[model samples]
Target: MKHLFLFLLTLVAFPFSYAQQAPFQDEINQFKQQDEQHFPPKNAILFVGSSSFRMWNDVQSYFPGYTIINRGFGGSTLPDVIRYAPDIIFPYHPKQIVIYCGDNDLASSDTVTAKTVFERFKTLFTMIRQKQPNVSVVFVAIKPSPSREQLMPKMKQANILIQQFLKTKPHTAFADVFTPMLNDAGKPRKELFREDMLHMKPAGYAIWQKALQPYLLK
Candidate 1:
């Protein structure tokens, strides 16, 4: 009876613990501490989002002349980004903000739809605009990935919705990386992905660099 009771407690405790967990909280805190020691330049381009942006460690190298700061944390969703925006995004005073989330939100849960994802993004956009009215906002279109092929349909839809939304907002741009990342057969190109077929290779970042270059504030 004691063993069974313990097992029941474990099951009950697991859900609450997991629910309370804030993904990448430590990583975000580290960025703040680093900033206190030596602040990142003001009026630079700030990149914030999911693992895609987090893994793009050398983003500054792509745009040699521009001052850029990347605040991406792996496995973050739109809501997570919004939740931490005040601490992560506001302090930097970036002239432009580039984002790349939502893929995780879609993959992590089956219930989340493309429309819902877009709505969350709008919420984030609204918050940013309220604080930084003239800031240039760039949304990198979700790229098709071989590992997450099953989720691509929804991903594509989210990208389209976001891109269209950007069209209506002045000083906002969408980097349509979806088209260039696809093969003629309309599938995610395998070469662009790593062995995991998820994250990216240098070749993949190369494509992003090209797609986003024109949109970067001069």
Candidate 2:
């Protein structure tokens, strides 16, 4: 009888153990708490994703008049965003959301395939759309970072899947930061990258600002 009880306990505990083993959840949570503290106003524009968005120190200045919120957390993946979506994004009731994520998921040691990345993206988009029907959604194509140059093919594949999905939604737009960042030789321009080669330099951010300006609400 004791053995039977123990077996059932293990059955329930196993899934929790598996689910709780997320190696990146803690870092993401810390970022979410920081974001909650700086919570943007309702009906504002939100930039949610990884380092590119997080590192945008003057995102609001780039798009003046529109109340913009930066919910970017460096080093987070799409799965991480979904895990903390309720706390990080849902409550704000943003008018629009500009997402730039998944690069870390592919380049990380997580072993997540391109297809898995695509599926997770669909899940994230669907969750947002269902919860915020009136919110406009814009996706920035995963930038071609000089540091992550080797991963460009996977990035392109992810962008292709996302772009196709964007086509079906009227309010959704895909901003193509990828093509302009590339040189005539079809490579990430070194000048745009900081010394780390992974993050964007001010020039890069300027380009991002230029690309983003037109889509913003007047």
Residue pairs in clash, model 1: none
**lDDT tens per residue, model 1, 1-218:** 99999989998878677667687788888998999999998999999999888999998899899998999997899999998998899988899999999888898889999998999999999999999999999999877899889999899899899989989999999998888989999999999988999899999999999999999997
What's the CA RMSD for each of the models? 4.0, 5.2
TM-score of decoy 2 = 0.83
Candidate 2 lDDT for residue 72: 85
lDDT, model 2: 0.84
What ranges in model 1 sit over 4 Å off? 1-21
Expressed as tens digits, the lDDT of each residue in 30-91 for candidate 2 is 75676668756788888898988889978888887888878787588898889878877898
The C-alpha lDDT values of all candidates are 0.92, 0.84
What is the clash count of model 2?
0
Where does model 2 exceed 4 Å of error? 1-39
Clashing pairs in 2: none
Output the worst ten-in-a-row residue range by lDDT, candidate 2. 19-28
